[model samples]
Target: MMIGLHSAPFLAMVAFVVATLVRGMAIRRATGDRPWAFASAKGVQRIAGSSFALCVAALLVAAALAPANGTNLAVLAAIVSLAGAAIVIVAQMQMGRAWRVGVREGDAPLFVSHGLFRFSRNPIFVGMMLVGLSAAIVSDTWWSWSALVLFVLSCIVQVRIEEAHLEASFGDAYRAFCRQVPRWLGLARSA
Candidate 1:
């Protein structure tokens, strides 16, 4: 069993890149006419894009160098990727017009408190992180984890900036919503 670049890791990386690019371009088309709140948001999006590129590059390198082993890690990685994909789909369905990457002011879609949003404020980011982590796990490379960590941190910063912009635009409504929802991981209901 020759475990190398042609194995599961490389395929997973390619799938992730294709999915991300397709989704991102769709989002750009969806929100192209909106009035964004901050110009820096575009820069942040570009940084995120670059970080994803780095993640794919690292995954490819790891795949190329991975030792031949029939460990269960590959199976776990596939499960995680599938789970992440499901989460992304659910979040996207719930978001509808609110499924944007940047901050917009003009009578934007109302805040959604149902579906995935009821659990985590940023389900899409969570899903993306899960996918990245799964890729790292599959590659069995420390550098893959580093890329995932950097991508997650970048997302956190972007989320904070987005939250501020939303609060400014949506006023108390946004604040109250934030108070109720967890920033990252979804928590159980308090009932």
Candidate 2:
């Protein structure tokens, strides 16, 4: 088990899970007085996206351990995943308590477009995408490819839902931010 931990796909999955757990704890602690500050972004879209992501993670593990997988790429995958994990950490830190798992409703009025949020509307999700890509590279299997495909498709839907929510919730402010910042990264067109 200890040796298996070094496998790239497993490590990537673990890193993603651990980072999320830490973020959850941070959210709980930060929201001690104002619990409504956080919420489940849960919705039909989110549920479907989350299901695909979970499936990918599970399938990647099995693929990574299979005999066809090689060690040479594992280290590279591990490095990429670590970098992605680092991004997740930074994004979560920036959000602090502002991070919610899904679209928030009622009361919370803050729109964060500073820090890493300025670079990417969904930094955490971007980082997770990196993690998924790393898993695919490490496993180099059809299963892992399926996982990556599912994750990418999920992100497309998730982003649409989230952007719609942000637009509705923050109105002009969010639209301005949208104009200012590219959805993933790079410079946004000026409004």
Candidate 3:
């Protein structure tokens, strides 16, 4: 039986741990009127955002501990996801202390149109999705796919909620940024 720390499942688990640590650091460094992110998300955003955590846990357990079915492609995907997460960290750093987990109601800190934000209106979400997708790929299991679906669903719901908040907060300036930047990537194609 192939079972050990050197297995593919272990790689997935390690990736999850590293990504979570990095993400946690980013969240820890966040600043703003964070009266909700730690307390609660607020309405539908609450449920969607909460699912994100559950999905992560599910991915870690199912993907990281599943039978070592991961292939070279899975390893490559894992590398890509880790790299994406690192980029997301850099992007978050660009946001400085203005980052928060969920949409903060009544808090309009900055529109942040520079750095990676210039590439995508929500680069953080894109990176996060990549990370989740990597987890799913490495896991090579139905549970991991389920987690990915949930992650995507959660991301979609949260993005909508956040856009509404941004539109209300930054008004026309944010609208302009949205027009200039794509929702995900490929800024040139987007334009």
Could you tell me which 10 consecutive residues in candidate 3 have the lowest summed lDDT?
4-13
TM-score versus the correct structure, for each prediction: 0.73, 0.80, 0.80
Q: What are the per-residue Cα lDDT tens digits for candidate 1 across 77-166?
A: 666766666677678667666665566445456667788888788887787677666667766667877877887777777687667777
Poorly placed runs, candidate 2 (over 4 Å): 1-6, 33-43, 59-72, 107-109, 188-191
RMSD of each: 4.1, 3.4, 3.7
**For model 1, where is the 10-residue window of minimal lDDT?**
33-42
How far does residue 100 in candidate 1 sit from its true spot (Å)? 1.4
| Model 2 steric clash pairs | 41-102, 41-103
Per residue, candidate 3 scores C-alpha lDDT tens digits across 1-191 of 66532244345445545654565576555532442363466679778978987886786676556555446766666576666666667776677656667766776577777888878878877877776777676656787898889988988888888889889998998887888888888663344
| Candidate 2 C-alpha lDDT tens digits along 1-191 | 33442365566567667776767776668676242222344556657556655865564575357343347676677677777778877887787666666555563446677788878888888887787877777666787777688777777777787788778878898888888888887765666
